[model samples]
Each structure stands twice: as C-alpha cells, then as structure tokens.
Target: MKKFNITVNGNQYEVEVEEIKDSSTSAPRIQHQAPVAAPQPSAPTAPKVEAKKPVVTNGAGSVKAPMPGTINDIKVTEGQAVKAGEVLVILEAMKMENEIMSPADGIVKQIAVAKGASVSSGDVLVVVQ
Candidate 1:
C-alpha cells in the first residue's frame, strides 16, 4: 500500500493506493483510494453600468434654432424659466409647423428672431441661460 497527498486551489487531500500480486496469475491487482470531490466553481457576475445623456455648458448658454420656414408662433418670452426640452417657439417650415425645443434647463436670455419672421438653418433663435 502507498499513500500520497495532493493539493489543489489551496486545499490539500490525502489518498491511498494498493498493489496485489498472485502467484498463478500474470496480471497484478490494483486498487485506488476513494476520490475526493473537487470544489465547484462560482458563477460569473455581470458588471454594473450607468447610462447617461450628453450635456454641454458654455459661458453664454444653450442656443436652439428656429426651423427652416417662417416663424408661426413664439411661446416663450425673454428671461423666462424653461426646462430642458421645453418648446419655446414654432416655425412654419415646408408648410408644417415645428416646435423648437430648449436644449437645456435654463432661463431664456435672448430672443434672436421675432414673431412672423423668417429663419434659416444654423440660425440662433433663442438663448437659454
């Protein structure tokens, strides 16, 4: 009989083995010690992540444009408190009315275009502080 020790994952285990021989038989008999169960692996976990929207801040503030067509309605006045994505003005572009929303939550600092006026792309229609 022979005894041996094995270590795995910082754990140690002891085992025994035996050998037997018969005079009439050519083959030798072998015996193995009881097997020790291996430790089970833990399941992997998913990482936690957060989703956020993009925001930009400048010295002046946020600026949104009036649509392509004529100004049909102006809903907000200057120095008014407005929330982010608030509709400030409406423009009649391509025979359809479009609402120009505020980019950020702030006070309306300036109004660049007047009611019933025309505007083009990249034009600053209003400023939000």
Candidate 2:
C-alpha cells in the first residue's frame, strides 16, 4: 500500500503506506492481536496553493539585483528590445561589477538569471515587458 500527496507550507496531506513482513514464526501463531490505528484521510477541498509573484509586467521589465550576485554579464538576447536604463546584466557582488539596469522599455520578456547565474537579492535578472 502506498499513496502520498503531500505539500508542506501550504498544507495538503493524504498519506498511506504499509509494508511490514519479515516473519520467522517461532512459537504458535494465532492467539489474538488487535491494535491498528492509522488512517487519516479527509481534507481536500482544493484551493490554497497560491503564492505566485514573479510577473514583472508594467510592460514587464526587470533587471534586479543590488546585492548577492555572480552573473557577470549577459547583455541581452531572447527577443531583445530593451531600453530604460539598459545595461541589463553584470553583477559580481563583492568584487563589484553590478550594472543590471533596464526596468521598463519592454520586449525581452524573460531572462531570469543565467550568465554565471548565482543571484540572490531580489533576483530576477531581465524580463523586460
């Protein structure tokens, strides 16, 4: 028996798993054994998992950073059309390259971190409308 649909942090659990058979059988078997309480399945109305916030669209643009980074240069590509500051990538963090501009001129639509790719602070490098 095995059934598992679990999601933790947004709560959803229906789990049932049973596998126990080792058996050596020394003495006489069959006396009387009754102790079993493990079956809990009643919670599924569905409609909870909603934590989506990545849609940077006011003309959808983003080249975020400001801290925690290591994506040294990725100037633009993917359907490129950006221009509202327009540097678009180059983040090194402590050694400091940190340019990452362009927040609103549109049409790149998605880049989402990948040059050396190690971003953290705000982290969503390039999306541009």
lDDT of each: 0.72, 0.67
Among these predicted structures, which one has the highest TM-score?
1
Tens digits of per-residue lDDT for model 2, 14-129 = 66655556665555333322333444569857668854333232333555676786998798888988766667777898886856667567678778777897878776677676
Which residues of candidate 1, in runs, are more than 4 Å off?
1-62
* lDDT (Cα, 0-100) at 105 in candidate 1: 85
User: Which 10 residues in a row give candidate 1 its minimum summed lDDT?
Assistant: 50-59
Screening candidate 2 with a backbone cut-off below 3 angstroms (N, C-alpha, C), the clashing residue pairs are 57-60, 59-129, 60-129
Clashes of 1: 0
Lowest lDDT 10-mer window, candidate 2? 51-60
lDDT of 2 at 80: 85
TM-score of each: 0.51, 0.29
Clashes (candidate 2): 3
